[model samples]
Structures are given as C-alpha cells and as structure tokens.
Target: MNTFITLAIVLIALSFVYTWGAAASRRVASQTGEKLHSRPPYYGLYLVLWCAIPAAIIFIVYSLITPTIETVIIQSYFPQEVLNDAAELANQTRQVESIAGGFGMFGEPAPYQVQAAAALKNVEWIGKMALVALIAVAAVAGTLVARTRISPEFRARNRIETAIEMLLITCSAIAVLTTVGIVLSVLGEAVRFFTFVNPIDFFLGTSWNPRFSTTGHGGQGDFGLLPLLWGTLMITIIAMIVAVPIGLMAAVYLSEYAGPKFRFVAKPMLEVLAGIPTIVYGIFAAFTVGPFLSTMGDAVGLDINATSAFTAGIVMGIMIIPFVSSLSDDIISQVPQSLRDGSYGLGATRSETIRRVILPAALPGIVGAFLLAVSRAIGETMIVVLAAGNSPVLTANPFEAVSTVTVTIVNQLTGDTDFASPQSLVAFALGLTLFVITLCLNVVAIYIVRKYREQYE
Candidate 1:
C-alpha cells in the first residue's frame, strides 16, 4: 500500500512537472517570438520522461534490494540454530516480515522474533521515506534541468523517439535474457539428474516404472523415456492428421470463398475455441468423447479404452485448429492480389489458382504455423492428463492407455517428494528434454517464417 501511494505521488509529480514545462516552453516561445522546434505536448512528454525515468530506476532498484537487506538484518536476531540452517533462516525472515506488517502469527513469537520484527518494521519505514526523498530529489532536479533546456531549438520529438527506441530494445534484451535463464536453469538441474541415472537407459529403456526406484550409484527401476516419447508422438501425429488438413481447408474457404458477412461471423466463432479452457476440453473428452469412441469401437468389434491417446488426440486436434486456420488465413490473405489477377488472366480457375499460386506462396508461413501448433500439442498438459489415462506402458495400441512426457513430468513433480531422490530429479531431466524439443521446433518455425519473409520482401 505504501509503495502504491509512493507510485501515485511520483505520477502526480511527473504530471505537474509536465504541465509546468509545457507552459514554460510556450511562454519562452511567445516571449522570443520564434518558432518552437516541436509542439508543446512533445516538450511536456520530454519533461515527463526525464522526471519519471530516473525516479523509476531508483524505486525499482530500492524495491528489489530492500527485501534482501531486511532479511539479512532480521536474521541477526535469529537463534544460532535457526541461523545455521539456510531454510530455517528463510522461514524466520518470512515470519518476521509477516509479523512486522501486523498480519499476526498463529502463536506468540519468541522475544528475539519480536525484536527482529520491530527492527524490520523500522527498517522498512526508513527505506520507504528514503525512497520518497530520492524520488523527490530526482524529479525536482530533472524538472529544473529539463525545463531550462526547453527552447526554440530544442529537439524534443527526436529525443522522445530515441527514448522509445531504447525502451523497445531493453524489452527485447529482457526477453532474450529470460530465454537464456530458463535454458541454463533447466540444463543445470538436468545435469544433476544425469549424475544419478544413465542417459542411455533413461532414453532407450522401454519400461517407465520409476516407483520404488533406488537412488544413487546405479539406478534400479526403469526410468525410460521411450514409452512417454512414443505416446507423445502418437498423440501429436494423430492430432496433426486431424488438424492440418481441416485447418488448412478452413483457412482456404474462409480466405477465398466465404462472403465478408460469413467470414466476419465465422472467424471469431472459430477463434472462440482458442479461449475455452483446456481443462474444460479435458472434461469434454473424458465424459463425452471417450465413451462415444469406446462405444463406436465396440460396435465395430474393436477394443478401445475410454481414456486413451486416440480420445485425447481428437480433442487436442480440435483445440489447435484455430491456431492453424487463423495463421494460414492471414498468410494466404497476404498473397499479392496481382498474382491472383495474373492467374485469372491466364485462364486458370479459382481452385487451380488457390492450389498452384496462393498455397505455394503461403507455404512457408503455413508450415511455420503447423510447427507452432505441433509445439502447442506437445506442450498440452491438462487435456492429456485427464484424457490420456495415466498409463506408462510401452505399447503400440492406441486402444490401450499410454502416458506422455508432459504427463510424467507433472506426476513426477506433484505432491510432497524428496528432491534428492532420483524420482524427483527425473522431472528436471524430462523438462529439459521437452524444452529442447520445443525450442528446436520454435527455432525451425522462426527460420522458416524469416527466410520466406525476407525472400518475399
């Protein structure tokens, strides 16, 4: 609440500074009887940037460091035993912060905890005041310095544009750094997992019975990836079999044949599938689709499980249709009208033009979209979890239940388990594998998109 109030104060200060700077600039221009380099609003925005940017940096830096500082300070009051254990120290710090903020603990805290909480409250109060003072100084100094610089020759527009460009670059850098962090963190944990289990056995061994598995030195139980990997592939292939052709045809019809009114009505309705929760899809598959498929199989003298990969895949494909259709429609629509006109002038029919000209032109983007949808399919958890039936058997029969890498990852990590055990560590290994696969898919998709985009350009 204090931080929010501080933010409000900073915003109000910035607004005042902007109004003052804009009026001051206009006054100077009128007095000098010279043309202003940029509009008054540009000057106002320029001053707002100056007043807000430094103060934001200070506030952010203080906000990030203050908790760690408080934790360390409070730990000085912790009992020696608590201080000795990293986890205990962390728990104590959380308790102190909670108690200091008047949230009240379940029981009366120790004398040392009371002392620590009091000290923490004071430290937080001091930190907030210091933050406000720093922000005031930065804002006032920026307003004074920037307001003085607002003259007829000041290039406020150019400066503001450059500032916007820098902001965009900073956002891009943060995205890249986040990806790097994820890869490194997953890779580190996976390396630890490898120390406990053989990579070859984990990848090639057929069985996936990780329960009651012996840890350390030589792994005892089967920790195989083949069953999960095969199940994942089966579901993905089945989904693509359903999604690709249907989605592509839908895109073609919508882009080429549908009237404007129909297209307008249909597109959002189709995209609505994208917004429906996967959990709801899981329920739909489990209760409705699964039994329906099993009965259909029974009518045809074929065995089928109520919750199998086939059931999950059909629903998963339906879920991803929007991804393929929406992107393919946009890509096909982007094909130059001149090309279509030329095809028509050459006496080709609509279907021929669509097949020979438009599809070929949009192939790269369509392929990219397909790969992205495949990635989406591979990453799906809830639908697969509920519909794929928790079976880790290595089997080729779609009628039988089988598990997936994602399902296994969820199972391995769920509930209270010792992280030191190989069972838990295997989750990290599975995660890294999934990450690598999806990353490769994304990279290929990006390459295809960029390569053809540049060629078209």
Candidate 2:
C-alpha cells in the first residue's frame, strides 16, 4: 500500500480506538459513581494525541534517514574503481537510483550497476514495510498506555493545550530561522565577493564591465557601482515624478470630491492595475512605449534609444499607480471629518479645506505610500530588463539606454559561471547593496512617520 494511504488508515483506526476508549471510560465512571476530571471529548482528544504523535515522529525520523542509508548500502556494492573518487561515486549512485526508478539512463549500465539497481528496488520496498510496521506497533502501544491514564484525575485539557502551544512556537521559530538563514547566506557570499573586488573601487568606480574568466581568478572588469546606481536613481526619479502627483491627485478626488457611487466604481477599477503581472508591463513598455518615445524624440530633434531609461521609468510609474492611489486614498479618507468641518467654519473653500486641513493630517501616510511605490520601482526587474537598454553607462540623460544594479545582477548570474568567480560573486554584493539601500529607506520612512504622528497628535 502507498505510505500516505497507510498513514491515513492508521489515523482513522486510532480515531475509532480513541472514541471507544472515551466511551468506556465514561461508562466506568458512571458505574463507580465518580465525576470525570475533564469532559468526555477531552479524553478522546488526549487519546488521539498519544496514539498519533509518537508514531508520526518515528515515521518522520525513518523517512529522513532512509535515503542516506540506502545510498550507502548501494555504494558498497559498486566496484572499487567506480568508488575511487567521492564525486564520481555520488554521480553513479544517482544514475543507479534513476535506472531503478525507470528513468532514462545517460548510457548503457554496467553489470554491477544493473545488480545495484535491482537491490535498490528491494531495499526501498523493505524500508517502506519496516516503517509501516514500526508505526503500527508505536500507535498500538501509545493507545493502550493512554487508555490506562484516562481516569478521573487525568488533566487532559492542560496536556493538550501545552502540546498546541509548543507546536505554535515551533512554527514561529522555523519562520524566523528561515529568514535569518537567507540573510546570512547572502551576506557570506557578498563577503567573498568583496575579498576579490576592492570595496572602494566597487563603490566609487564609474564603469561596470564584468569580464568572466573560466579559471577561478578575479575577472578583468571595472566592477563599479556609480553607473548602475545612477541608472537606478534616474529611472526611480522619473517614475516618482510620473506617479506621485497623478496618484495623489486621483486619491484626493476619490476621497474628497467624488460622490459615493463614483468612488465605489472607480476605486476597485483603479486597483486592478496592481494585479497585472510586471512582465505584461514590460512587454507594453518594450513594444509600444519605447518605440513611440524613440520616434517622438526624433520628430522633436532629440536623440532617444528605442529601449531607454525614459521608457522603462514611464511604464513602471504607470504600473505603481495603484499602490500609491490605494494607500493614499485610504489615508486621506481616514482624516477626521472634524478637520474638514473646522476648515469650513474658517471660511475656507472645499479645495482650500482639503489642501490646508486634510492633506496635512494625512501627510505622514502619503509619504509612506510614495516610499513604497519608489521601492517597488527600484526592485522591478522585468520592466527594466525589457525596456531599459541594458547599457551600464554613467549618464545624466534619460533618453539614453542605461542599466540598473538589478539588471547587472541578473546578467552576472545568468549562465553556468562558477560561484567562486568575481563575475558571479559580484551579484551577491550587488544584492547586499540593494538590501542596505532599501533598509535605510525604510528607517527614514519610519522616522518621518513617527515624527509627523507626534506633532499631529
């Protein structure tokens, strides 16, 4: 039987056993004229917990160790010549397992490999049977022990609650540990990258040319930050210029001026922009906006690349409009009606009241929305990759093709480059730099919001 199906059957049988145990305990209590410490259901739950938890733990441990044990056993059967090198042994082991599993072989298998494949099938079958048998024995033993403990004085509720609390704590710790692991892994790789490329040159040099070398030494590349940084900032500035004013104005109209019916219809329609995938925006920018801008620039006696910073920035700005609009709208709507009313009492016009009273009250949240949109624009890859002509150049002109740090990272890590090479390692360093920049932006946003809240309150 399938292992999962077997597990399900075990759980179902345990449930019935627990039900019978709880019913028998209640009957015994009635006969003895004694009240149970906890309810009948608590006794059933406690029995189920005991029957399932230990058996599940044993099954999990066996499953995790089985693959390594099987690989070792199979390796022992291989010819000494095949097992001379550790890497070759691992590759051959994988090939044998694949053949056993009925996958296509890379080449004709040797006599020993064929024998090992057959043995692998047998070992796997035996392991599964052993696992099922052990789990069944554990479940039966736990059920009997738990039934004996389910007397009048047993504190079933406390035990169940403690188990649940520990489970929750374990889940929370896993999440925190996973995040820490990712950050540390990236940080370690970035340190290795910095060791090859001088920190000053990487940060301050103006060019970015990663000349990859097969031989693991550092490449003959500029490895500069200024060009990519300038490109990223330039695109982000253009995007903000396009997004902030328009999105804020839309938010103002929806919150203060638009009627209820119009607001309801328009709000959701506007937010639909955020749901479209970034790749779709990239396509639109590459095919439509970039060409149009290039043509328009020629007509106006200006030089513009078909794929340029201006094209990517404008499309990215349009893509982030919903983020800005939705957040700013909610913040503007949250400003107290009393503020508007007080402004009206001071003989201010509706526009004047919104400008002088409501906007000031919502300024902190609006700033936060703008920062979020800016961050989104900075992290965007597909839009910039498709539209921004991937040229790493230090330039002030938005009409020229340029590349950002994210694009450079993608380029560096694209193929089968060795991780030890500076070309590949530089991607991690770029990633770390981006992380730090975003972190600082968040800190500044938090500080500003807190200061504004203090004054407003």
- TM-score of each model, in listed order: 0.92, 0.85
lDDT of 1: 0.89
In TM-score terms, candidate 1 sits at 0.92
Tens-digit per-residue lDDT, 1-457, candidate 1: 5779967976787788789878988998999999999989889999999888888889899989997899888998988999889897888788888899999787889899999999998998899889888988987787778888999999998999999999999999999999999889888888888887889988887888887736633544679899999999889988898999999999999999999999999999999999999999999999999999999999999998999999999999999999999999999999999989999999999999999889988989899889978998998999889898979988889878889999998998999988878888898899998988887888888887787767556
Off by over 4 Å in 2: 1-52, 139-164, 212-219, 259-261, 333-353
**Per-residue lDDT of candidate 2, residues 1-457 (tens digit):** 7779977987689779879778967986888788888888888888888888889899889989998999888897898888898888989999899989999487799888899999999999998889878888998899889888877788887887898899999999999999789789989999998888899999998878788555423455678899999999999999998999889999999999899999999999999999999999999999999999989999999998889999999999999999899999999999999888888998999999988788888989999999999899999999999999999999999999999999999999998889898889999999889988999999999998998888779
**On a 0 to 100 scale, what is the lDDT of residue 160 in model 2?**
79
Among the numbered candidates, top TM-score falls to 1
What TM-score would candidate 2 get against the native?
Answer: 0.85
Q: Any runs in candidate 1 off by more than 4 Å, and if so which?
A: 2-9, 76-88, 214-220, 443-457
